[model samples]
Target: MTSAVHYKTAWEDPATRQAWRRTAMFRCAALLGWLLGFPTWLFAVVMTPTWLLVLWLPVLWVGIWYTLLAMVAVTTLRGIRRVLRVYPWQVDIAEVRAKKKGSTQFVVPVPERPEKSVSLGYGGLLGTGQHFWVRAMKSGEVTSAWFAGDPRYVGVVATPGPRNLLWVAQREATDSRMSPRKRGVSPEARALARAAGARVGEG
Candidate 1:
């Protein structure tokens, strides 16, 4: 008897939006470093005199390698910390339809974009669909959740918490039981969600 609820994506929240913006910028910088580090080092090597190469080439190579490695390590660690630091966004609970084995399925529309949705898959030992929230991230990425409450007002923790692999496995098991259905919000939807979030700051 639970009807669908219309709610915005977490990105719609102002604080969450700003935090994700910082995260995105950090990631972009990391990616740029990964792409340009080797080429920049190679260029420096090529520009050096042959005599200098004989004396410092190995040192330069080792230094560059370690520098690049450190950049990658720091970027990855910071990204993880950023994600963990951002609090989970509250979801507007939409339709809580029952699936196989008493599991439940729901879709939270990515704010201002009707075309995209964040689908949640819930699974637990109770078979009452009262625990474990799971959602797909980018390809090869995993996300999971823990939830509380019931149909009227349910609370969800969407952060990629500890025990990620375990939650992912539980999600996979729950998904396997689901009928053929699409998962995750689309890229376009995500972009729109970001745009909408940005507008909130502008206003």
Candidate 2:
């Protein structure tokens, strides 16, 4: 289901080359590889009896180790690709509400479940770390292609357009504390609140 109200962000600007690096994928893979070394060594030691009894067991273990190492290598390669590609993505915060028979219902966008990253190192063949980035966008009318799995949010991507701009806000404080009517409220939320006959001061 889609929300009828369409909102755009004047503040949504393109991301820089550095922003993608902060993504969870890069950090997770680095941690995974560093952490896996110990367990891998333990597994090899525990399987020694089997490796001695059957040559194939040793070979299989070696294969598994190498495969993991290769995964780490692949993850690093992907990270490099991100640095090179450096696409621009639009970030916007939105709230979706679905209408029921007569009343309106607030729809909670699906939350992202944390993922466990597996290290890509196994003994003997260039084992490396592999990190996977889960969905970062959701499918929607304006953002279907970049749409990730969580239907609650939508992030649109744009090519590196000719123009690059940054918007910054500076508030002039009359007093340290904002009046109850002048606190933190998003423009979109304020608009919605006003339309529903509610004041737009504090959320």
Candidate 3:
């Protein structure tokens, strides 16, 4: 698992309204850019003839405007993707330490949070590195597992010592059969939970 996972700020809190607001802002910005383009271009064209030395200024301005517009569109789309019901996920871990005979203590780590994603593709939009598809409950058992959409391979990170943490991604089609009990909530419910305690119809 890669440590540089790019989680959006909007996803950190379970506020549907806020998420919606952010999405709406993106749309509004997109609209504003579209509406402003024609006028700006027309104005630039009109001004160019008045100043022969600046005849090429409009071309440069349009290039810069389009470039900025594209960037805004990309950022908006990325923000939208981050909050997608099918793409977002949250993973939590719980660790336990027990004392045994001969003054020996054993530590065990258990998953406490939910696992989710935007799509069923292998690796995240960014690389998820190598991961595993744990088949059974046997300790130290490991195997390779492909993401739902993509066929690329990623390494599954697991707990190192006792009471370690490991949260892996799931395949879309096989999530029902592969995920843990509580983690197997319905897609809608999972989306809510993954959003850090968001609930549907709670507007």
List ranges where model 3 is wrong by over 4 Å.
1-17, 47-83, 91-203
Residue range 78-181, candidate 2, lDDT tens digits:
43322123222223322222222222121222233223211111112223112111111112222111211112111212112311111101111112254323
Q: Write the per-residue lDDT of candidate 1 for residues 99-186, one digit (tens) a residue.
A: 4565545545444354565555454223223233322322213332332111111223333322221111123222335432124434
Which ten contiguous residues of candidate 3 have the minimum total lDDT? 146-155
* Model 2 score (lDDT): 0.30
Q: How much does candidate 2 score in TM-score?
A: 0.24
Model 3 lDDT per residue over 1-203, tens place: 32212333323434433534554675567556766776776676777766653765666565565556445444434324333333222222212122222121112122222242221122222111221212111233422121111111111222221111122222332244443323334555444334421222221
Better of 1 and 3 by TM-score: 3
Candidate 1 C-alpha error for residue 16, in Å: 1.3
Lowest summed-lDDT stretch of 10 residues in model 1? 161-170
| Residue 203 lDDT (model 1) | 13
Better of 1 and 2 by lDDT: 1
Q: Judged by lDDT, which candidate is best? A: 1
Ranking by lDDT: 1, 3, 2
